[model samples]
Target: MLNEGLSARSPKPKAKMNRLYPLLLLVAAAMFAYAPFMILAAPYESTMGLIQKIFYFHAPVAMTMFVSAFVCGIASAIFLFGGRLGADRVAMAAAELTSILGLIVLVTGPMWARKAWGVWWQWDARLTSTLVLWLIFQAYLLLRRFGGPGSDRLAAGVALFGMANVPFVYWSVNVWRTVHPTTTVVPSLQPGMRGPFWYCFLAFVLLYVSVLGVRTRLEKRRAELEALYLAVEE
Candidate 1:
């Protein structure tokens, strides 16, 4: 009865997701295709000029990274507290994406900084705290990959710490008055710049969601295969 109940319920979510994937893929593809032209048409900043264009990509991807980190942390919390294998799979996928997107933010930040700040890197509160958040998620992935049994729980605990810093990262520039621009920059964007800036933001977010779904499905398949192998061994 338990086996029958599990089998009956499991396919519904997968079936729904299967139908949505194509739509998501199409929309994400269309947005990405059109994004460059939109970006090129926008005016450059007076101070940084052309170099500031990287902000279109950098800010959006960084926002996606922040969202990904929270997703991973929330999923991790669910897995840790509820013992849900499905949530663990999601947490794993989100952690990997966070790490990947965080890398983009880190690299682009330096490139933008070199142009704007006249340095490749700075030890400001914002930069330093962002680095710490990225490192914590990286460590979670490493622990998941290399640590012994029960590592997911340990990694989940670590992820909670990582998620805790999200607020600090955003507020750091304001509180510390660093070389980096404050979070208020986004809201205060000029009329022409705000349109393309937010357009790219939506595009990156959709891309992240589509990629995360695919990655989570892969994790689910791996978990099922592992369980089947263990059943056979028994």
Candidate 2:
């Protein structure tokens, strides 16, 4: 009866998501093709030279990580307050992506820092805050995996905290003394360089959406399977 009811509900959104999967793949392929050109077209920095190319990927990945944390935090709040299963699934999916993107940011950051700063690590305001934010989300994922009972609430709280740190990470250079660049958006680069950065940024955003869509669908299927198992057990 549960299965029948669920079928009767006929989730039109699932169909739409399925239709969009191939479109996402196409976008990803285009991104891969465009990335090389974007990197090559951008002029090298006077001080950082060719190593500065990492900025194209590093900055955008950090931005995507922030976005993922924001989405996860909001969905977690919804799940905690409204007890919505869909929100829980979305939160989990976003959390997983957040961690993945965070790892990329951390890796790319150290790479750039090593070349530009003569060291692999620093305790600067932005760097430390971003590291702390990544660690907090990492803890959230671990809790979701092994925190056992009552872990969801704890994880939700951690996610919320992680979201709170994002602004501090972004504004740290401007607000405090730091070796990191103040702003990379405008007035920091030549017009030719801005185009590649923006293009790569858009690519990363599309990639995030694509991955999130797939992860959400997998979570939904897992939920459905659990429901079927419970019905069978009964």
Candidate 3:
């Protein structure tokens, strides 16, 4: 009965998504396909030169990662206080994506820093805080996997902390004297580079939205199956 009612209520929204999912995927694909060329064409920074070009990928994806953390944090908040399982599923998916994107940011960051800062690792404020944020999401995932009963609430709470850290991470460069570049980098971009940077940023966002939709839908089905099993046991 639960499964039947759930299935009945879901088709309309799913159908509407079906109409838009393909288009979203297509646009993201088109942007990603041409991103390389745009990055190559942009004028190199006077200082960082070829290495600075990585900013096109690194910065935009970092922006997307931060947004994903917020999505997870907000969804987790709703789930924790509202007792909504759908929000929990979204939080889970967002947590997963955040971790994935964080890896990219962390990796590309050191790549750029290696050339710019002459070091692959730094214990500075920005880097450490970013690592902490990534670890928080990873811990959330681990909790969801191994945390027996009532883990969702606990994971949601943890996700909230990760969300709280994002602003600190973003501002750490300026708040303290860190070797990391300041936030001014984006706003100060040269016109030649600004176009590609924004192009890549939009692409990452569309890609995030597309993936989040698919992951959230899958999580819903998995939740349904779990519910059905519980019903059988009862």
Candidate 4:
């Protein structure tokens, strides 16, 4: 009976592909191709030279990870309070994508740090908080896998709680002194670095949205597949 109840709650299958989806795919591919070149050519060339270009990818990925976590928290809250299954699915999708991007940032950050700071790792506040956030999402995914009947609710709670660290991570450099430089360059609306920086930032944001959309669609499909599998068992 519990199995039946669980299966009943799963979502229905999605429809066939549409025209807009293809356009999104094209845009995603274009951005992926364009981002690396812009990063390499950006004007704020560090003493480390071209290698410092990794900063473009690292910082933007970190920013998008925070955005994803915030969105996940909001969706999780809606799911818990309103019992909205779509919201729950969105939260799950966001969490999964955030985890992936967080891993990318973690890897790229160390590379950039090694070049810029002459160390592969450090115990700075920003680094520590970012790692904490990554671990929380890792734990969230694990709990979902083994949590049994209340998995959705448990994961939703984790998502909401884990996201409380987002602000701390963002402000960590300001909140406390650290070896990591406060800003990549001096702050200005029209700074010398603004051109390539903004272009790279936009490319990354577009890439993130594309990847998130694809992952969410896959999650929805997986939910439908599980539902079908249960129906067959019955």
Question: Candidate 2, overall lDDT?
Answer: 0.79
lDDT (Cα, tens digit) per residue for candidate 2, span 1-234: 357436733379878877797698789779869798878977878778787888898888888888888999999888888988778888889999888888888888887778766788755455566677778788899999999988888888888777776776657644564454433221276888888888888888888888888888788777777777778888
Candidate with best lDDT: 3
What is the TM-score of candidate 1?
A: 0.88
lDDT of 4 by residue, 191-219 (tens): 54566666666766766666666666667
lDDT of each: 0.80, 0.79, 0.84, 0.72
Model 3, CA-based lDDT? 0.84
Stretches of model 1 off by over 4 angstroms after superposition? 1-10, 168-188
lDDT of 1 by residue, 39-62 (tens): 899986787788888989988998
Q: Model 4: residues >4 Å from true position, as ranges?
A: 1-19, 44-46, 168-192, 230-234
Candidate 3, residue 58: the lDDT equals 89
lDDT of 3 by residue, 96-174 (tens): 9999999998998888878777789755565666677888899999999999999999999999887887777668744
Clashing pairs in 4: none
Distance from true location, Cα of 197 in model 3, Å? 0.2
Order of models, best lDDT first: 3, 1, 2, 4
